[model samples]
Target: MSLRTFKMVIAIVIGGFLIAGIYISVLVVERQGALRQISLYNPAWEAGQAASEFIRLEQRLSELGRPGSTVDRNEVELRYDILVGRAQILTEGRFQGLLERNPEHGATLRELQDRLAAIQPLVGELDRNPAAARQALDILRPLEGKLAQLASAAHNHGAALVQKDQQELVRLHWLFSGIAVSLILIGVVLILLLDRHNRLLTRAHQELHVLAHQDALTGLPNRVVLRERLEQGLAGLRAKGPSLAVAYLDLDHFKDVNDSFGHETGDELLKAVAERLRDCIPVDEGHTKNLISRFGGDEFAILQTGIRRPEESAALAARIVEALRAPFSVNGQEIFIGTSIGIALAQGGVTSSQILKHADMALYHAKADGRGTFRFFEPAMDEQLHARRLLEADLRKAMANGEFELHYQPQINLKANEITGFETLLRWHHPERGPIPPSEFIPVAEDTGLLSTLGEWILEQACREAAGWPRNIHVAVNLSPVQFRSRGLVQSVSRALAVSGLAPERLELEITESVLLQDNEATLSMLHQLRRLGVRIAMDDFGTGYSSLSYLRSFPFDKIKIDQSFVREMSQRADCAAIVQSVASLGANLGMPTVAEGIETEDQLRRIEAAGCTDAQGYYFGRPRPARDLVHTLAALRQPTEVA
Candidate 1:
């Protein structure tokens, strides 16, 4: 039962006990009254007494029979009156109720009444003649038997009533016992429940404490604990302790691991890395002065105290790097990952925020310097870091400010001996900086999450620009890997095609092999979706990625653009020539065109044509040009008859 219901039951039990006690008490009082009244009302006692009194009246009559007895006639009348009055009491009230249940008691009472009536005449005559009273005494003798029977019946009925009363009292005793037992059991159950609740509360409080400080996956201290410890170290430095070192560490290419394997394996790898970090902190003679914590994802933090020199922190950083240098075996696969550590040493009353910022800046420098290394915080790094942040912020506003423009580079079809398509290249012309190289801002755009916006703008603008071009010529636009990850990528392409009034067949989306790296299934699905719209899809920079062959087999392509690196070296290197030849033949067999990129010299172009490359693009064709420049270039490159 519920607690409320149990309490109600307990109340009912107690109330029942109280009521039963009251009823038993009242019954006991009535039983006692019954016992006392039995002396007067019981036919047994009264009948015996009346018989003795009648016998005495007979003697009194005998005295009247003798000469000069002197027993008054009024005294004889009083004796008869006493015997009859006791008999009348049995016929009334409680005695009457008891006798009604038993017919023998009533019958005996009636017999005695008849005998008393018969004697009444004899006793009355005694007052008339004293000598006649002797004969009246004889009439009373026969009444003894009837009086005895009345006494016996009264005794049995009274005993029976008393026995019934005793049974009722016993029943009340059992009921009170049952209620008391139930109440005790309820109290015991309540106590047990309360104890269990208290234990659960205590355990939950302890778990909450652990959750506050510890990481669920790694069992290491989390960001909250790291912050507290870092602040404590800063406070210690202010109070005349050794200079402290706050190090920020991040795993390099951790996302690649997650994309390659599932998240479960990734989580196991994180735990493994956490264990290594914990083990990397060395035990010192004068008590350990390091606190390692997870700063979320693949980033971790360390607060190192008692650092006498910069070399100590460097050595610690090296240890962390070396420890993680070995490949971690997760899910039966060996995966190699690197750590970039940035240690910011105490600099004259350094606060926690300052150290955290400096350490993070230093980490960025370490990653920029090529990961798997550590960098210490330098005074001048702040200026460069601030500039990077400002540049990223400006790049975000580039799309809104209309600073982005697309330049087209011609794709030469060696077999047709004419320009087939112009690959759309994005160029950002800053209002203040004049012009910025795409290499400089593209990474920033990607890192700042502006790639999606810039990519969409490039798609729509390229389609719009390509709309007015000769219908025979197709426009090729590079789609970033980040853009393909968007759920609305196919819709965005459709909208661009719809708005620009460009035919899907005239717009070609160029995707590098890197786009297929993260999720092959999703990438293939998106490729199929674009193809369904009647648009052409080409795997650009084909041999650049590790799994170029696998990606080729995974999805059929409209065209394969060989990476420029192989094309630039194809004349000098036989392996490069063979690779280009093999790729061209492979594309022919697959019924897809092969486009060789970075063909600058005539010898390179002639050699690629001999090697069966159907199309080529590089500085030889022309550098990427603006739409105005491309309009004249396209008119000049068209067939002589069309030009006339």
Candidate 2:
């Protein structure tokens, strides 16, 4: 019940009790009044005492009438006085009312008073005159029956009053009994109401506790409960013989799911994943020591307790990985997803936070290695993660400090044997570490969500620098997958071209196949928007991804750059050469320029040019140089080649 309703019931119960008590008090007071009236004045007892006194006085007078009697005159006078008092009592107060109500009783009372008055003087002179005693007896003897009749009448009236009083007493008794019953019923109702209120409070408290410690979406233990369980397990690790394993599980590409589908569908998919995770562990019989919790979003944590070895945790992780591999049907769509797990074994001297951190680091490595896999936490991973965090922190500062610069690598047209354009490459120079390789800091920038900002800076800077170059040469800039995910990507590109006053056709934006892997419609739409800007688009690092050929069909491109790995091994590996030639032939047929990257020698260049490659960009032609040196490099490249 609501608090207001509960309070109202209590108020009603108290009011009932108060009303019952008040009525009971009134009944008790009335009963007491009736009892006091009946006990204080009893007409039947008064009449009997008066009659006995009359008899005693008569006998004493008879003794005085005898010759030489032993009866004392003073005693006879005392009897006379006592009889007078009794007659007075019978005619007063309640008795008077009783007698006056009956004509016969009233007349008898008058006659008795007259008789007593007439014998008052005769009693004292009884010893002196025997005739006086004889006269008294004659006067009193006629009134005996009258006195008896008066007594009988008083007795009948008293009996009637007692009967009426008895009825009133019975009524009072029933009234008191009824009030008592009412009080008991009220007490019962109050008890029942109070019990129900308590039960409601208890249920509300339980629900609050659940809401505090349980995940609302998945109904799993939340992070708060997870931390508690992990702490408890860690504390008992030394006392118990078995080991503890904390596994950090993250749904791979879960953000993509949320983006592609709606958040509601993503929520359903998370619930399904939680169910699958629960099914993967053994929790029946005596195996109740394990705990699985949702750490919010697409992240979950599992605690395996009382395990014999690390292998058990590994097996559990493997089971979870396998269980999640199956397609989940959410909102009538079969969505295929995967998980990356990181496991940390608990030992002496390790805190819960440390273990969880280690597990998270391992999870990062799992995702880095590729999703749908698991990895055990290693000491080396901690160092690596620490370094990565430091790098990410420094990367942010580097962007603000203007410590990065760009170099231009020339893309050669084999037919013209001249420089066509320079690919814009980013180079970072940290204050403390000097030059940091792109391989090391690029992933950190992407993971740290700084790539979009950095990519914008690169695009504007490259366009600004290329605007000063010869009007015939264009500039190519590489686009990270992270940049395409940004809603402002097309705007950033347009802003760059507008600010630099560079020709749209002279700005080439290069992207890898990974950019098309996310939100196909959005990606294609963004690509079309960029295409409408009159800028050239090239597929960079072509043939590096599984869906590169499909991506080529998905979007038309101005050029295709053959990945360096294939070009590097083309001479040694015939298949590599054949694959490069096939891509070149395909590009030619589609009227798209194909640039072979990483060409270092004449033999590699000759092979690519003869195999229908239109362009080449490698160290053999020119290494990437800064814009200051690029002017001279371009001037040197424009020089005609001398025949041997």
Candidate 3:
């Protein structure tokens, strides 16, 4: 109940008590007055009866004394006795106290006594003579008139007192009734107020619940609420075989928006996007169930239910992408954002965590392909992701346990058939798996963010291994794009060179095209820092990416290694040979030496040399081998070589 209601109820109860108190007081006062009046009336009536009886006794005596009449003494005595009894009866009972208390009733009792004394004298005179009796009778008549007048006055006064008491009693009754009515009205008012208060409290509670579950910015369900809903949907799906779909949506380039504009603008853009998503989902009572939620930051999740097939989820994913493709207006600025959606559907044997993981894996694939796309979950994708996770765990242990080893494949100067350098490769020897290939684990290391440690270790190991080799032979180690983008890349390389006691001129770092495609300032700064430290930078796998001639001119590179794909295709495709030749000519013009990789035959080696490639590395020269074997190969290169 509300305060108003409580107050009103209290007021009504108090009013009732007040009215009851007044009525009780009135009843007590009125009853007391009536009792007093009745007491006075009884006394006055007794006095009048006594006086009338005395007058009657004297008259009877006078009648007996009349001429020639005989008086009966016994009859007169009996009549007097009866009159006394009547007077006693009038004075006795409940009203006797009023006669004793009232001065007027006391005086009236004395007057009655005086009148009876005078009547006694009259009775004696009547007994003596007839004339005397007649005179006594006449006097008795006047006394009787005076007594009647006094009795009538007393009776009238008693009647007036009784009337006054009756009036007070009636007024008391009305007052009590009025009080009761007022109390009833107050009670009614109190009930209404209490009811209103209760409703208000109920509404406030509901509003509080809504606010707790909803996002303050977008008025959509928040992450906590969304997770709860997802769990409930998943539980239902577990019981009955209904397909449940979850799409993890991330706004592409959201960081760019934050970098370009302020966070305020980014927030506005997110709210707008949330509204668009809410509007895009269809509401159907029968077929489809959809709920959009803000999953914090620029990420959102959509729970789609009742999907019959995987393609339906894919279609929903596409629709989400389309919905977010439109530009949003934030603070008068037009901001465009694309979305990458990862969708996972619940089949029979999937937990919520596994489903979310699959969705994240699909999200990874979507981002890998490009932004503004959506992908469905695949079981093999989950296996691959799990493998990467396992590799990351093992990589951490590998660094601690010294399980990483370096192998070098010699890159030969094809024209002289002389060893120029060895390309460093890292191999992981897992205690359980024995040997994990670089092709399978390198990408995993990069994705798992273990490349920073792994890359530096390889650099140090390779530089130390090459320090013992001939002075002309250099060591080349591959750098992942993730490692190249790291802020500590230059410092790490400088430290490795220092620790190994290897000439920085002989320590070559091989980077792929992906590294050059990163942020210009950071990548360029890193490259320049490496050059300043006397470390050679080579562009590896040149033909596979957006490798332009302009990059060669813009950035100083020591060499350009043709990708193995083009090198292997040279014998079958004339275009491959011509492209390789063109790249080598371009490298020569730019003063950057060219290295052809994957040279398997003399024909491929001849084509590379004819194309003016300076260095070659493939199975034809030597496959990647341990340092001991590579040292022997290097020592054999020191001997005079026979031309092919």
lDDT winner: 2
Q: For each candidate, how many residue pairs have backbone atoms clashing (under 3 Å)?
A: 1, 0, 0
Alpha-carbon error at 526 in model 1, in Å? 1.3
Total clashes, candidate 3? 0
In the range 58-98, model 2's lDDT, one tens digit per residue, is 88877874678788778888888998999888777778677
Q: TM-score of the candidate numbered 1?
A: 0.45
User: Between which residue pairs do clashes occur in model 2?
Assistant: none
Better of 2 and 3 by lDDT: 2
How would you encode candidate 1's per-residue C-alpha lDDT over 1-644 as one tens digit per residue?
45576567657656765765686676567556645653543444555565577566666666764677788777777877876787776666566764677777677767667767877877777757655565666666666676666666666766776676667667656766765676676568667766766686788899998999999999988889888988877777655446778899999989999999988889999999988887878545133488888989999998888865455677789999999999999999999999999989878867889999999999998999999999989873455467778889889888888888899989877766778889999988988888988867887787678889888889999999999888888999899988988777999999999999999999999998778887889889989999999999998988767898888888888999988888889878999999899999999999999999998899998888888989999887677877766743444744354312
- Candidate 3 overall Cα lDDT vs. reference? 0.76
Candidate 3 residue-wise lDDT, 397-494, digit = tens = 98899898887788988667678889987888999999988766776676677888888878888888899988988999888778876788888988
Q: What's model 1's overall lDDT?
A: 0.80
* Per-model lDDT: 0.80, 0.86, 0.76
